[model samples]
Target: MAPENQPTTGPSTFIGENYHIWVIKIKAYLKALNLWEVIELGEPVVQPLRVNATLNEIKKYDELVTRSPRALTCRHSSLTNVMFTRIMTCEIAKKAWDKLKEEFEGTSRVKSVRFLALKREFELLKMKDSDSVKEYSSKLMENVNQIRILGETFPDQKVVEKILISLPDKFE
Candidate 1:
């Protein structure tokens, strides 16, 4: 029985053709140009390093390479940090809020603002009558406002200011 026709599957081996040799030559060319790193798997497999990252994130990682937008290699940390920054921005938080609002509206629920106010009023009333309830309504209200601000889908000046203050200026 020919190996090609064998139904048994674990891992199968195959022979390479002249195209494989051509690919090796191209990889060599890329290496010479310092465009890519060629990882030689025992069977002549070439892995290109800089693949599958967003344009914006990649640009921040390496300004020179991003300016020309050439194929180059990157470490996983670089790619991960780019993705992390995009996710952490206030704009992403705002999208999440918008989606929540849409879902709440579809369910015929009272608006978030009205619901929050009513809840606060009830909590205050309970606090006045019952000492056991112990409601932190003001803190809750502040948190709600923060969430609404976060859901604006844009960067906030206050956030930028805070970040700037936290980091020491090397130049000054």
Candidate 2:
């Protein structure tokens, strides 16, 4: 029987808008299922000379092959039909993950462009008159997180300073 905490259904479909969030969620799901290593490092190559191997070694190899296909199935089940089709040829979970990353996360040049745009958004972020302090903080944090994920580092003090500067005069 499955554990009470284990999800019986797969994660939501990914249509490409929030790849970062989707990746994080899917990774957590895979990790929970003990399938993340296969998606990251890939399946191990089996030795043909294993005919002389010990029984325990053979059992371990069998376990690996069994896990690989299950991981592949998990990967396919989590994606949309179109996205799944793109990675259907992938025999291993890692290959399918890499293909999805390359397609949705973009190349280095594209990432650089995205980083610059996110930076601009961060710079322009200001607490609107209608927004509460919590709402403003949430918006700021989201931009900060996206910037960090794109490989830009902002010191905590710098983020605090940005938040302070963005506040309305009432907070002064």
Candidate 3:
């Protein structure tokens, strides 16, 4: 659902088009509010399911984690542990960081933090390192929180925000 006056077609609807509108859409979608609700409240509505679905698909291995706890704890722990470790290595982290960099270019780019921070965060989470995990998780979670705040502050970039808001917890 796009807003009444906002254009939906052409380049205006791109994921990184306008951060303000994207953020607004994110807040509404995060609250589980639909287009009808937004319209009723005199707010613009926009659907960002395209980007959301693509991003959600990034968790291709998620199904492997939802199996029985015993299976995961006993058999899969080592495997998953190793997988996440590999994902966090400098090589893999660099690739992912590059992809994100390409996705959000110009003013939308969030490449302020160093690549090592992301690698360390993923490593701590994978290893279940209590102290390290707490630290990295806090930092990563802070970034996510900032995104949410952006969604709240911007009224037009609702679609982009909604797509970001639907991001799933990696380990949950």
Best by lDDT: 2
Tens digits of per-residue lDDT, candidate 3, 76-163, equal 1222343334324323222422332354432333433433344344334322334354554455565444444433232334434433
Q: What lDDT does candidate 2 reach at residue 106?
A: 89
Q: Which candidate achieves the best TM-score against the true structure? A: 2
The parts of candidate 2 lying over 4 Å away from their true place are: 3-9, 48-55, 128-130, 151-156
lDDT of 2 by residue, 56-164 (tens): 8888778777777888888788788877889999998888889999898888899999999988998988899888889998998998899887768978897889888
Q: Looking at candidate 2, what is the lDDT of residue 132?
A: 86
TM-score, predicted candidate 3 vs. hidden true structure: 0.17
lDDT of 3: 0.36
- How far off is residue 91 in model 3, in Å? 57
Query: Which regions in candidate 3 have their CA more than 4 angstroms from the true location?
Result: 1-131, 152-172
Better of 2 and 3 by lDDT: 2
How do the candidates rank by lDDT, highest first? 2, 3, 1
Each model's total of backbone clashes? 1, 0, 12
TM-score of each: 0.18, 0.80, 0.17
Which segments of model 1 are wrong by more than 4 Å?
A: 1-58, 61-97, 105-109, 116-120, 127-130, 133-172
